[model samples]
Target: DMEIKNTNTIQYRSMVDKLIFLTNIRLDIAFVVPYVSKFMQTPQQTHLWAMKGILQYI
Candidate 1:
């Protein structure tokens, strides 16, 4: 089994970028994408939890 590491600079950037692009077509995720982006500099467990919740909403 492997543990999931929530923070990976390149991967996180890539994902956030994709989410930003998706925002154009999915207005519903717009707010959440930016919301998640703000924590990129120093993401914490709570931020990841929030993002998961947002994803579930979407």
Candidate 2:
């Protein structure tokens, strides 16, 4: 199991926080947002990619 850590956890969390806030207005992402939020404590590259995908989705 080779897990790569996200270099910018702060940025990742910030984005996730914003996504959580957006969930109130964009119900489409409500489900996925929480899914990604699960990795907030120790986000990895894959997690960050998921977040980016969410942004693209919006």
Candidate 3:
């Protein structure tokens, strides 16, 4: 993925948004989403990877 600015960017915004939505609907599966969501103000690549893994797990 291309390196970009901060959470204001589209990619990060979309990823975090999806994670939040999915987490709300499937809390039992991706319980970690809430914790990860805390970083939405300034998420990093690690958070994105974790969200991706959570997506795969779900």
Q: Which is the leading candidate under lDDT?
A: 2
TM-score of each: 0.62, 0.83, 0.61
Judge candidate 3 against the unseen true structure and give its global Cα lDDT, from 0 to 1: 0.68
Question: Which of 2 and 3 is the better model by TM-score?
Answer: 2
- For candidate 2, write residues 1-58 as lDDT tens digits: 3323444687789999999999899998888887888888888778788889889879
TM-score of 3: 0.61
Q: lDDT values of the candidates?
A: 0.68, 0.83, 0.68
C-alpha positional error of residue 55 in candidate 2 after TM-score superposition, expressed in Å:
0.2
| Better candidate by TM-score, 1 or 2 | 2
lDDT of 1 by residue, 1-58 (tens): 1234434544455667777887888898986787789878656667666766765676
Rank candidates by lDDT, best first.
Answer: 2, 3, 1
Q: Runs in model 1 with CA error above 4 Å?
A: 1-15
Q: Pick the candidate with the highest TM-score.
A: 2
Q: In angstroms, give how far residue 44 of model 1 lies from its true place.
A: 0.3
